[model samples]
Target chain A: MNDNPFSLWVYLSQSPLLWLTVTLVTYAATDAVSLKTRRHPLANPVLHSLWIIGLFLLLTNTSYTTYFAGAQFVHFLLGPATVALAVPLYENRTRVAAAVLPMLVALAVGSLTAIVSVVLLARAFGLPREIILSLAPKSVTAGVAMGVSESLHADPSLTAVSVILTGIMGAIIVTPLMNFAGITDFRGRGFAAGIAAHGIGTARAFQVDEVAGVFAGIAMSLNALVTSLLVPLAVTYLLR
Target chain B: MLEQIARVLLWLSLGEIAAKSGLWPLPAPVTGLILLYAELAIRGRLPDDLGILADRLLQFLGMLFVPAGVGVIAYLDVFKTEATPILAAVIGGTAITLFVTMVVVNRLGRTIAISREPGSERVEGAARDVNA
Candidate 1:
């Protein structure tokens, strides 16, 4: 009953290759929509891309496992991508050193602030401990966030949400807050976004200026380094 | 192309070893990065093709985050279980972290001479006094 070619794309619907295709096309469409219009903050490429991908998976009854296979192309690049960003960080070394300690301090304090606020709030609201723990340390990059969540015995999904929301919030607010604080330097603003927002924030920073993108990339690398270390310790020592 | 591939592979292996070694606190990726830099130092220059590969990779880096972003959908149970706390953690934590980071970095910028805010007369005045 099933035609080989016709059913192929349909059966492949659940294949990672198919899902990855859907994922990329979904993002491209959303990005086009955002660009054609006013580049609305909420219409963020990551956020909208996720939405379309999610809907496709839901409609097609495909699991994330099927998607990850194809999507690994993107994942595989993440390491190289981080190293590549180093080029810019090196180019901007003078500026990077200017606030190295500050960035470290921000990451530490930021990690703590992120974890504590969630746990305490969850406690206040009488939420389950697993969920609270999951929410902790979610402000970091997804890899770190997922790692932290797994280590903490929290749901990776919850932590993932916390991380993305934290990033989107940071991308949206960092500029205005910097304006208010009278700190409008592209490097400073970009760095702040990168540290707080992680990958998504890095993307948003690029939109503001090339300098922002450059510094944000630097900040992101540094933030990933710090949170990967600190989030675990915080859970083992303090949160537990 | 082969040389570029070899170097990239070299960098990846070095990073993996670093992560497995448990020496510095950085992740395998960071360790990988440090190794890449060291390789560059020894080689004295990264070839153009390698740069091109890296550049193309970086362009789609943002989209790479989407799969992880989908993790949010899976964590829907997390929302219900730790609703208030999760919100507080993300919102409060972000604002505070951004604030404190900016303060420390700004102050540090003043101390160092790489001021991000180049036109600020106050910071300029302070730097001049220090230089004088």
Candidate 2:
């Protein structure tokens, strides 16, 4: 029973509790920062949380594998959260039914454009096949994007990061970009944000306007479906 | 709460079985999403507990990605080597997707005159009433 500070840390870090507590605590702090700024898109809690945790690991010489041993609890929720999207979709069924035509068009065009543009740009810039494959699903929600990456045999971790980055970019730029384009339709605006950025963009839409948020929710779910299917087909064709 | 958790897990389990069996090309969670949605559509009303459960979990949805996103640290070398291309693809591709999708959809809405058409009410004011 040689109980010293270093021995305690070695013991604590080996257990899942330490990293799990760190993950949650870091998120709560970063989330407060995001809230403090009135939910500013640039102040994304996930982005802040990741870098903070990442840096902590770097300084401490902790491997991601060890950190993930505890943080997987949070990651596991992504599956149930994906399923939970049904609640919003069910609640707004009437609105979805009304604008079926435009939603359908947006889904098709937006989903294709997201996949194609990423692949082509990545390829043109001479990114390797694996990176391009991972980038293929960057526009989808993180969970679904990771699944797509796994199916394509690309790096799911890389895909997850790309998806987050894309979401942050979409959330930050959606309002200003839409305003500059002189588009006032919340439906189209929300749909574009959801399709282009996924859940983070939808969160931004919810902050700005309820109607936009609902439409963004709808678009996010629908685009998740469309992008998952399209990514496989598009990758095979484009990369072949 | 226990019942709601069980319900979600039940659907998720079935989704996993389906995915593992290669019966669906979609991810397990996605298949679960569809199954849950179809069940709700058939039932024609959201279960109170289920809705509550969803809201509770989804409120902090952003936090869930932290674990995976931190995996980026392991790939610092990848980012350093290909930062330019990767950033260009993500930022540029997103902008183009947003611009193209919004412009096209907005133009379609205007040309269709969805707002003026009676009983449609797909525009701003009517959207509130529907949600309300």
Cα displacement (angstroms), candidate 2, residue A108, comes to: 0.8
Chain A TM-score across all models, in listed order: 0.81, 0.84
DockQ of 2: 0.49
Q: List the residue pairs that clash in candidate 1.
A: A122-B85, B15-B32
Among all windows of 10 consecutive residues in model 1 chain A, the one with the lowest summed lDDT is A86-95
Best by lDDT: 2
Candidate 1 local distance difference test against the native? 0.68
The residue ranges of model 1 lying beyond 4 angstroms of the native Cα positions read A1-6, A37-39, A98-112, A232-240, B21-24, B41-46, B115-132
Clashing pairs in 2: none
Total clashing pairs for each candidate: 2, 0
Report lDDT (CA) for all predictions: 0.68, 0.82
lDDT of 2 by residue, A1-240 (tens): 565888888888888999999999998898788777767667777778878898999988899899999999988998887788778778867666667787788789999999999999999999999999999999988878988899999998789779988987898888778867767777788889989998888767765665577678777877888898899999999999
Best by TM-score: 2
